[model samples]
Target: MSRVSNMVAEFVATFPTTLRPGVLYVSGAYSTAAHLCCCGCGHEVITPLSRAQWVLTFDGTVSLRPSIGNWTLPCRSHYFIDSGSIRWARRYSEPEIEANREHDRQLLADARIDTPGGRHPLIQYCRSVWRRLRRL
Candidate 1:
């Protein structure tokens, strides 16, 4: 994995027309972060800020949690953006990638279930059945 040095953070109300490598563009208004692939692949990575997804932290320096895994890219680069630095993560096997994808799907599903609008009817029925079965 190639290390990206001299990373910089820029706060923009909207993402620029063209993204530049080595710069992380943060849009608080849109709750998103965008940057070119740190591996020098030049692919634009747009991470949405949410409780179920990437969480941006600013403590004098910008940081993101749960590492960015570009599994779809040919490079399949994986790294963490921390304090304006690119910390490379170990490459994952195909099985590991599938597992991670499943985990992310479940997290998103759970988040939707917990939202204020109310649980999905199917999910609510499943939960009720499980509760009743557990009492037996």
Candidate 2:
């Protein structure tokens, strides 16, 4: 069941060779988080930490900003990580997904966080996502 619900936060300098379910591994050095999909599909989910993307919050428990929508995954799991709990969100239509994706791309493009890095970060991110999907 995707109801494996609560996730334990483990701070790491980088991701480990294998991912375990119900554990949100956070890398402060990389400003990223990774975990097996909350839907129990075993697919890995990586959320980049940034103002333009997901932000990490640590009050009592850890939380990731926004929601995670695994639309490409077979389960299409959608949920929020709030204070270590998985709060499932409603599923979106294909059109809504595309619109949201495009909007996110626009946000990255607008940020121009890549100018200093030479290549467009959005492009690199999209390419990495494409490669991952291709494997899927």
Worst lDDT 10-window in candidate 2 = 118-127
State model 2's lDDT. Answer: 0.79
* Candidate 1 per-residue C-alpha lDDT over 1-136 given as tens digits, one digit per residue, 9 for 90 to 100: 2446646877776899988888888776566789989998888899877667777776658788889999999989999988978898999999999999999989888888887673344344434543553466
Evaluate model 1: give its lDDT: 0.78
lDDT by candidate, in order shown:
0.78, 0.79
| Model 1 CA lDDT for position 73 | 91
Runs of candidate 1 exceeding 4 Å displacement: 1-3, 117-136
Tens-place lDDT digits, model 2, residues 32-136: 789999888889999987656887676659788789999888989999999989999999999999998998898778666546653445445544543553465
**Candidate 2 positional error at 19, Å:** 1.4
Clashes in each model (backbone N, CA, C under 3 Å)? 0, 0
